[model samples]
Target chain A: MKKYKGYLIDLDGTMYKGTEKIEAASDFVKALAEKQIPYLFVTNNSSRTPEQVAEKLTEFDIPTTKDHIFTTSQATANFISGKKSNASVYVIGEEGIRDSIVEKGLQINDMNPEFVVIGIDREITYEKLSIACLAVRQGATFISTNGDIAIPTERGLLPGNGALTSVITVSTGVQPIFIGKPESIIMEQALKVVGTSLEDTLMVGDNYDTDIMAGMNTGLDTLLVHTGVTTVEMLQSIERKPTYTVGSLEEWIEKM
Target chain B: MKKYKGYLIDLDGTMYKGTEKIEAASDFVKALAEKQIPYLFVTNNSSRTPEQVAEKLTEFDIPTTKDHIFTTSQATANFISGKKSNASVYVIGEEGIRDSIVEKGLQINDMNPEFVVIGIDREITYEKLSIACLAVRQGATFISTNGDIAIPTERGLLPGNGALTSVITVSTGVQPIFIGKPESIIMEQALKVVGTSLEDTLMVGDNYDTDIMAGMNTGLDTLLVHTGVTTVEMLQSIERKPTYTVGSLEEWIEKM
Candidate 1:
């Protein structure tokens, strides 16, 4: 087995399942911590800030800090800042995405913006979608944090940012640049934040579509754990196989 | 020119354009009345009730009554009732859709609904979308009032019901049964209301994509007026042409 110098991990499925703790997750992270291997939690969730995500991981007894988190919100802000410094933007999202854009010095303008960014917004209104459509129609660059269609919640699968983003896309006839998993944009940014070369980094997650495809998109090795979402049966149906597959993260600790 | 016994006219672009009256609309409708031809105003707009739409057309000096107005909302309610009388429906729309459903004696149910209907809603919220998604995922039949992507307003083209419907469609991975123009559903229902045979009725409108296409879809002869969306230059590009093309309704008054 090839030894990875650093690791990029997923949040909801890999580290924990919703609010419940995964038994192998704590041990797996502790192994990485003891070995002094840098690992960052790369999450597509743009609703919550790094601090909030770190706190949740900490509650689960996983060694985490604000620096250890890399959200799609941060990736989106980084992407926009790279394009134009202090660009005017029309945003439709929660505090996480809003704060990230503002922290990067992007101006939030409802009218005549240079860019339109959409993230997961539970407090979303028709007015927000209307503004986004109008802005996109006016030739604003459209961007979305991620393209996850349904978000798994205790209540059931709810509409994700990708679903909400479709309103503006359909209305204005403009496709948005998605900056999350399965896209190289978020993966490349996560690699830089994790301070790891693409070849030396291992992307670990339970989702075959998002996490594994994201690693493949960014030219990194992927480890699929069967703790959530994709099972062994699901993997057999897929043509492209992950670099490694395990029943739990604990199975990979010795190799790491 | 073939003499049509009845007419199904469009409202927005044919009758009036956003509170502004079309000059040729009044004389044309008066001619229809004078000739004693049975006519009904067919509209894709599901946000307003028949009475409200009739009131607006009356204000525009067109001979219109609630009985002479057929809206997509009414078509949707009728569609649902035809499937199952008093069927439980989960709706995400404005007063027009809600009232139409209730008037048809359909029960409004958020939890465990038999059908999920979407229409244009200025007051749409995330919770409404969430409920619709959940209901659709739970096997409720999804229905959209119209597939119009954008609504032209004084400000600009805003997100229409189709755009809003995409949120639920994309999230739930379920396609909705669209009940408006370009689909034969609304036209078939409007034909029943207008008391006209398909061969004897002329579908008249300014928009080729909606009104003319609706006519074509339902096997009705179409007259495309160059007053709104589809222009002379735009019509030249289309392979399929309307049965008749006129500069204004005034030109057709003589034919009536």
Candidate 2:
């Protein structure tokens, strides 16, 4: 616990799932406040903007400023902006994708887009799919925010934007340049927000495949939380293991 | 038409769709018969076996034998068999996938598989996904039957097993070696079947993106059919034009 200075935390499965927030998530927030240690809420879910995520976190009684949030959406936009400063893009996604692209000062139009940006388009129509496919086949760059296939819902799992991306992939047979978490782009942003040396920072989350994998890929100490998506049973059965395993952030705070 | 020996046709858009066979499909077959033109039904649709496809074609009263049919599943199995000879595979697909893999004299079990062979798992599950991802990341070769994300349905086009393939991709960053039509891998198999030269082979279909693009990529003559998934409106709007466009395969026979 003494080795960790700043925490790079995950949202969604780690903190909350839909309307129901995690039990010890609030305690983790309080621990951060009491310790006065820097931490940033980072997520691979590109469905929401940083401001949107902050609002959700604040609504859950976890104090979150806009500055404390970073998303894959932000990383993707930054990456695209650097590559093509003013290229046109045809988007097949939601407000998050459009806003991120626009923030990077990229243009989004119906025709002659230099790239067909496929993000998480939950409201995907056949018309939109056809348009996105057409633009990509004409030699436009294809970029996606994240590659999550399905999101767990109250009733069941629903297909996410990754499904929409596959539509274009089938047409073009080209993979998108994914610039989200674990891709080194968002990890850089997280490192900046946490303001801790990479060696001293810790990423605490539930999903080992995404959260722990991203931290490991970015050279950060990772803590595996086992209450959310990846349950204790699932973790114990797995062959690949994590650095540090904790029941909840509250337990970690007690140890600290 | 004069430059070709006989056409190696594709199914779906090239010949028929569902219960509503293309208007000129039967007539086109008759023309081929009259001219003693040898043609093989090559399809990337891994859902149905060659025999199943042949049966469906016969339902339309079009003369098709099991011997005259070749499928991507068959090609994929042949590829894997030739490489490993008798390696074990963890099969996560349907009858077509199992039949093909078994036909190649390959051993399949639940143990440590040499490869995790992913075909069209129409009824895809989270357990299968987790297993496949884990197996592939653990150094098992991840081979995809084809890369078609969606197949046509009465409701609309539904995302296929190829959509699921992206999960393994985002997890491992390992591109799948797809053995299906439009890819040179399957095209080579179809060519080998007919003993036909690439110049003489015509890849005919309704979809310009996959079928036509595959033809274009492999230097095979292509004919875009109007009666399938792609409408004339959609075709006219896109810049990736097909080599030749036809109202129907029956009408295209007139050219020959």
lDDT of each: 0.94, 0.76
Q: What docking tier does model 1 reach?
A: high
Worst 10 residues of 2 chain A by lDDT: A155-164
lDDT of 2 by residue, A1-256 (tens): 4557888888887787778888788888878878888889988777778888899998888879988888887777777777788888888777777888898898887686887777765555556765666667667788887766666665344555565466567645778877665566678777986799988888888888778878888888788887777888888887867778987767887754
- Of the candidates shown, which would achieve the greatest TM-score relative to the real structure? 1
**How far off is residue A198 in model 1, in Å?**
1.2
lDDT string, candidate 2, B67-160, tens digits: 7888888988888887889988888888888888888899886566888877766565545655665666567888888877766656445555
For candidate 2, give the DockQ. Answer: 0.08
Interface RMSD of every predicted model, in angstroms = 0.6, 7.0
Instruction: Compute fnat per model.
Output: 0.87, 0.07
Query: How well does candidate 2 score on lDDT at residue A149?
Result: 61
Angstrom error of the Cα, residue A204, model 1: value is: 0.6
Tens digit of per-residue lDDT, candidate 1, span B1-256: 7899999999888888887989999999999998999999988888888899888989988888899999999999999999999999999888889999999999999989999999998989999999999999999999999999999999899998999999999999999999999899999999999997999999999998999999999999999999899999999999999999999999988787
